[model samples]
Target: MPTSRSSSSIWTYLFLLGEPEQQQRFFKELHFISIVTLSFGVASWLVTVALMQHRHALDTQSASLALVGMVAGVTITALGKSLLAIVVSGSASVLFVTYGFQVLIAATDDPSFWVLPLGVLITLTIAPLFSGIAWYLAVSLCVWVMLGWEQFPAHPQQADQYWPMLAVVVSMLIGLSLNVYFLVLRIHNYQAQRELATMAYTDSLTGLNNRRRFTQSARQLHRSALAPAYFLMIDIDDFKQINDEHGHDVGDEVLRKTAEVIAGIAGEHLCGRLGGEEFAVIYQGDKHGACLLATQLIETVEAAFAGERKVSISIGVAELVKGTDLAHSYRRADASLYLAKKNGKNRYELAAS
Candidate 1:
């Protein structure tokens, strides 16, 4: 079976690229760490090559030249660090194979003439199949080319040359795969959190903002310089009597139907269920708008409930004052609502100053 590594690699790439703002901090941290690690690898490789030359008493000029090339490569990578990390890590495998083949060629007289042909065939085959696979092939190919196939001596220790190349290829693949996996996991968690937040703020029964969300929205509106808005609290008249006379099931149906009637009349106004038998609306306009909406709501509910067990509702409207909070607005509306019930059931009242 093909490994989970490939699947994980795909997920990681998508996570990093998806929801730019949501994952921006993670991306930034990943970029910084990648750059630091890549720099260290390049530095260590150059140091190792220099030490080997010194120990073997080989020509210092060759080692010095190699060190310069390594430094230049490191500098190029650091300058465009993010892009280079992706490019290098993604293509590590292909580079290893390609440079490994060149080394093999240098060590043998008639290095398999098929090496180039086979490498090309493999590169072409994998590149179109999967991004990570294509990248691995490309990196391996680059590594083979860099190993200098022309200089591979006849009596070489095949194990030494091949093992280091294999190690580099494996390490790069592992790192890339792990990075992508964790990134995808983070994205999934973020989506779940967003869904939970939405549920918390929304009323499932009415499909409106619940009391909690209404308070939050009111605070937002209070900060704006818009026209004075109104808060209207409404309660079904003798709702407990309805539940007692008719079954609670009928009472629930009545409540649902009443919510629909109020929502239809409220139109663009924000409406929500504050609690049992009580609903609230926030209208972003003058008192006239609130009065019109209240009248419409009263008419709609009366019409809808005319023959359905003779139900009725009381409404109270309060205009938002400058420098007032949601609690105060709610209190005002509630006071008006109490007056409407006291004066007569099935009526509307505006809060008195």
Candidate 2:
């Protein structure tokens, strides 16, 4: 049966295009950005105070507002409120923009000109989505306001007028370039991590879930399933003899064929290659349904390899109930599989209730 889509899964696809683990990593990166923003604010404030020794505290009200925003960002992040942290971070970027503009309006060559571009860069790379868009409008407003006023030095020399304007354009371009670099770097890192995770959880030979992934998936399925779940442990009959007679290449082909059969029959069910001629499935069904599936798998394998050497499978079924240990259930299924092998090797056996 098709299961309902989960809210978490939807969020994963929409926001990060990755797993829960990647989302957690994103939150951590956000927290780091918050810290770095706060640190930058502190450093810039110190530079402003040292450079303008004659300016009173009342003259630097924008600096005070930026300080408040930085503190709030730090506190909210410490509380583990990621959404609130993002909001505060965006607000801080806005505050920094106002503060930096004030400083530049006062002294154009005070080494504080970098502050405005820094604020713009923060909003572009790390701020909330809507806030990032709002920042572009804010910047356009600033440019319009500057065009009407004489913020630049009133000198006869043409260099005086054009040099400051050229600096502003270059600074903005640098910020935009940095934003693109950061975005590409983050995407590459995420893709690398996802690939590493896939390698860890998959069986390279058969393209099936390895033992570790199977165990994790089975336990999760056991917890969520509303109906009784059955663990089906399957093993190829006389697998070693086939390897001896037909060579390891044929053995590999047999393993691949078996995996294909299981995948075809299972169809969205939790199944995996549990190492070396053995496979398992966590089937959501009763004993009768489980028996029917086992019988079908046995006959399908036989028919698939009929032209060559005969191929057969033995399956062991064990019911999994709520509040029971999954490891114990697996052991019960394995024991029954051993019994099936002892009782003539080409049939299934059910574990005692």
Candidate 3:
């Protein structure tokens, strides 16, 4: 459906990465998790600072930074600036990790803050391709920094610290693998939605817009139309007889071939198969152009199947009026279609204004 090469490439990239509608969905998810995680971090830090104020002086500046960053990130996400939201929130997360690591190291020489980067695993799962990779690397860098900083500054020769560090490394590996698995699942779900939408909106037999899709689109076009518009109601002449005489297989071939011909000619317009042996096209042009198109459809279809079997079509033409609904225009076209068949099939009749 993408007409240009750049657009097609962009669609392919989006498909490969994850949800095509990634911006809004990613921002919303990020906003939600950032709110929850950052709120908890700020509250827990505030409580810790309060309880430890008398015993040991603790810095509350990082907690204040986390609160402010969360607000800014939520506002950016609401504005649909997904990349910026990630950057803001990620900066806050970095502050939390670095500050928490410092506090834990100074007070108890504990490396428990190693698990903090695991919070960023959710971002890896939800972010777009480049962003996901960036988060993964950022989290990895944070973990490595904490491990190296803790070793170099204190307990560099402590053999018992190696086991806990090893465990943290293994956990990061597992979390990264799981993030990849969930990202694949997310892409599969988005593709499934697209396939289901196509099945619902497309005609399986002719590959045209089904009646439901056609009516919805036609009504919207009618309401917004600025140019002169016309509707053509078309039917295969004596289609039942063709099916009865030559088997249904032959009838199906005729329908498919006819639809192809109509689509080729009216491909630029709103062409669709209304029902069995009935097709319609909504053309944007004057009366003369509409009549000429109908004539072309009759001539082309006849010439396409001339050697195999005689196939012809009757078309009804009705100009769309600004004040009238599409249904009224359809009825007018249907009336003219009847007359075209009555006066002798394979002809077109234009409905009077």
Candidate 4:
């Protein structure tokens, strides 16, 4: 089942969505978040003055710049590219957070320097999740440097200012460091999971869909089929002989080559390996088209070998009728497969029943 945007662990869900559709959904989540962040920027400016003890209103110019940057961020996101939005958002956030922190300091009393570190915490919490590693480091470094600029122009009069700015730099570094560390681990884990999924659903020898995936795909295809759907069961002829005469290594290569041949013909259709030298194809088309495909499979494999080793396949195609599951259609194809072997090998048998 697909996850909703309101999923509890939305960040993890977005990263897990590597498929085309899921990726699109992930960006939609980001799009919504960007809107929220932009709204918050506007609202914060309207209320920043009220939060001050002296009732000193913050710099309207800096607030305006921040709002303008966020509007640009939201507008760029409307173009529908999430990565671009991240860059734009990160750039805008840096601009706003830097100036916003200054305005916050201006509105504060003696411990005004402490407000900058708090701003660093807020930026670290909000910024890194939307962007990649490069953008994260870039934005975090910019925030630290912008705050730490006062460190270079050290004077006895301004010595106290260095302490809080140093605190802000340390805060930014630690927060961003933790973010990078966890992101690396999560990405590695996700890649491992994806690889395992591929291994589980694919045949190791042929790189074709395995039996489990084949049955699953066939069931799905059957449901969506408008006309007629066929399950073609294919078996390599004298496969045991090849293994016995040339060893399993050559036999494995033959199976891989055979899978490629079938896959080449299957094209937009689905094919799978049913263990050993047996394979299957789920096709949607007319009986004549299915028969033509089976014929092509037979002729192509028989003529594929020019070396001392030659291979052939016997196919059994069963047209799935209404209210019939893959198991029922498979039984008919199995019977047809037996008939093909019982009569003559290197042929295809169509089960009309």
Task: Report every candidate's CA lDDT.
Answer: 0.63, 0.69, 0.69, 0.71
Candidate 1 lDDT, tens digit per residue, 243-343? 99898888888888988997887787778888788998888888787888888888888899777568788998988877877789789999999999999
For candidate 3, lDDT tens digit of each residue in 1-353? Answer: 65698675455433333333854544554556555554555555456556653424433464456456545544443453564455455544545544553453345334344343433333333333222544554655564564346343235467675665565566556656665555555556656877888899888888888888888988988999999999999999999999999999999999999999999999699999899999999999888899999999999999999989999999999988887889999999999999999999999999998
Tens digits of per-residue lDDT, candidate 2, 1-353, equal 43455665444433432454654555566556656665565566567567764555334566566566656655555565553345445444545534554553454444334434544444443422222223333443454244324433334376566665565566556554554455446557878987898899999889889999999999898888899889999999999999999999999999999999998998877899999999998888888988889888888988999989899999998998688889889999999999999999889999999
Assess the local accuracy of residue 285 in candidate 2 as a C-alpha lDDT between 0 and 100.
Answer: 83
lDDT of 4 by residue, 1-353 (tens): 55775453445433333344434544555566666665565456547545666654566687567567656665665564754555466466545655565555555554344455545666566553543445556666665555445432234366484675576667767766766664555456656767899998988888889999988988888887888878899999999999999999999888988999999999989999998889999878989999999999999887886565678899998998768777899999989998999889889899976
Model 3 RMSD, rounded to 1 decimal: 5.0
Worst 10 residues of 3 by lDDT: 122-131
**What 10-residue stretch in candidate 1 is worst by lDDT?**
124-133
Stretches off by above 4 angstroms in model 4 are 1-102, 137-183
Which is better, 2 or 3, measured by TM-score? 3
Question: TM-scores for all candidates?
Answer: 0.57, 0.72, 0.79, 0.70
Q: Candidate 1: which stretches are off by over 4 Å?
A: 1-184, 264-268, 304-309
Model 2: lDDT to the true structure: 0.69
